[model samples]
Target chain A: MSGSARVLGVLGGMGPLAGATFMQRLTLLTPAERDQDHIPSILWSDPRVPDRTAARLAGGEDPLPWLLRGIAGLEAAGCGAIAIPCNTAHGWFEAMQEATSLPILHIVEAAADELLRLGITNGTVGLMATSGTLAMKLYQGRLAARGYECLVPAEEEMARLVMPAIELVKANRVADSYAPLAEIARRLVERGARAVVLGCTEIPLGIAAGPALPFPVADTIDALARASIAWAKPAG
Target chain B: MSGSARVLGVLGGMGPLAGATFMQRLTLLTPAERDQDHIPSILWSDPRVPDRTAARLAGGEDPLPWLLRGIAGLEAAGCGAIAIPCNTAHGWFEAMQEATSLPILHIVEAAADELLRLGITNGTVGLMATSGTLAMKLYQGRLAARGYECLVPAEEEMARLVMPAIELVKANRVADSYAPLAEIARRLVERGARAVVLGCTEIPLGIAAGPALPFPVADTIDALARASIAWAKPAG
Candidate 1:
């Protein structure tokens, strides 16, 4: 990567809408008086990458090679760093970082860091995401390493509430997501969660930050967007 | 471009949000039941490209080289077709198409084709866009060639209603853009426009397709997105 070029590579399309939402958040987060002041991004939105959740849980094809192709495309285009917005896809983060010298920003790590920044140290954070994300321990492992207790929905709730809500969001029926998601958040709060982390990108699209839930929600997309902005900023 | 590869190159970052929105629309518009079923896209969202409207109207730095670099990046990455989401930047569409053998999809041409598809032939259409788009006669030239009369805001309306609304949208205050734009639509309808073409990408972000406006609105982003989907589809 050239020292003068501050391009951010986005490794996206784990779900195409999540990837695009991340880009939109990045645009809104940047403090730009003019178009030139915003960060330059190389986005390879190849939705052909195999499904992450199905691959983790049900013997679907591995998405690594397709993801690697996207990473290489961005690297070849001279991107200095990379950000992947899909939370479930972080299962391959370490391997992806090893595949390229480009600094890949992890969505889980950013969310964990956000928990620390928000003064929620040593407390329980509720996580709402796909079964694969929980099964892979994407958030649990990171939050545990950071000395924070992670709370998740029980198996019944995961099957009956969380997964269905995520699917609804993927299908673009966001209005139907609010009630089920709010119920899950309320349950997490009853179990002593300080803040609910929207571990899935689709979660934020359906749920708004308001008084309907019992806890403050930390959106992983916003955390990742902030991290990307920081990564693209010029060094003093 | 190779005959086997079905890739879409996006020449974007002329107001990065619009570019991102275009990508999201493309993803939604594609008839994909699974991940790989969607089109492969290479997006170069380089915001440092010189401002198109400013360059056209105020003798500012030219945006063509930066645009060409984006197009070349896509082509080198194995893209078979290219789409640019910016409207004012369409002022250089012919020259850009000449610069590369890759098929370049035109926003105005797409809008005109969409109008015809909607049975809007031989009728007057209203245009709402930036001063640069108007001054360059971007929509009028193409629509006239396609045998349709185009109506633009008068100079006073351009200065008072259209340009300010565009600026507000650029600043991300899209909610405030509704009333003045509705008024413009009504005035254009009174002057004999059968439908309104949202020639600028930002207009759709601000104005919703509803019964409030006197004329039917045609979104250029949707038109371009549809054109891209057609371009990327496998031929029988």
Candidate 2:
């Protein structure tokens, strides 16, 4: 399937609100003269699934079972492929694929490939992602092949710069809550970051590159959505 | 009840893709830290809902039933309120509230409140929504009361300037697709329209104001999201 008629299935609810946010991005990403031009999608929000970080830390509740169930539902509903928007849930990708017959798109891998194709290797990338995702070595491990060096916020930087700002949006605090992230970016720039990777989808919501940013911010969520648009369409 | 722990429900599926995109926005919008800071959300993507245009034309299947089902799910799940990202769905707001005891946030009205507060009334707003949303008078009707003159693209202009460019993103042809919308926007400025609204969420994904536009492109979405942030957590 090129683009016009492909169906997308979302295996989500690593946090329910985030799942909804991904759906919004699809609309923001698609070209529609009306709402109908948007491709149909199936989303299964299973927030009850084990917390992604907890699974990584304690091996408590695994997301693979719920992920498989959601994928099956989407496949039965006729989805062409599956996407999990949660930045952390991607850690279970191997297990998730083993559980489903349909093709599951890998967010980090997609991001790495796009970074490679964009020739973004060798720049100072100040990564902004969930603590779990950052700790998991997702970006570093993937980007290592491309020779791109990844830098994460210091522990104090995460507390002072990142988490509160992201929390503001989670708490529905939008524009005014940007100071913390902005301040963090400023420091990152002071520390010699050439570009900032909005690795967490939520970070891009209220914040974007300003004329005075430490550097340009690459919105990877937008990149993935744009990629999805390409993957779903007919060739020219 | 505030941002600290609010649950938001979404009545969605005007087209499954748009709903999915909106969900991505929610994730992007949040500023959560340890993951627990994220507000819970629920989504219902029912692609079976008749096209909004078709339903308006011949009184086809009313989407109210499905909309209500979604609202009910969120309320049942303990959502404090709801935000439906679909612009056209708001046309049925009356019927939607009839189905739920929970409060629903209206994007247009909420946006209007922000606009009025910004003192931009009587300002010329270049409308960039889908032909269907405009034809249905969803945004135009509400915007009229705010003393704003809404200018739609001329037929040839819309076809040559707007539609094809929008179709490019939907069809997933994004590279160089922006030239058309920017050109059309320049011509609209010559016609004396002051600022563009980026009315449709998807339009922002296509052509947005950087250093290129003739005037300000007020992204109403950016307004809504920013407003939600301040409203959620006012500075002391």
lDDT of 1 at B99: 87
Model 2 residue A18 CA deviation in Å: 4.5
Going through the candidates in order, their DockQ values are 0.55, 0.16
RMSD of 1: 2.8
Highest-DockQ candidate:
1
lDDT at position A225, candidate 1: 93
Best by lDDT: 1
Candidate 1 has a DockQ of: 0.55
How far is A211's C-alpha from truth in model 1 (Å)?
A: 9.4
Please report, as a value between 0 and 1, the fraction of native contacts recovered by candidate 1.
0.63
lDDT of 2 by residue, B104-221 (tens): 7777776666555656667676777666667777778778877777888877776676766755654445445578777766766777776766665546555642345656666545
Model 2, A73-117: lDDT tens digits are 556556687878777777778887887788787787667665655
A201 Cα displacement, candidate 2 (Å): 1.5
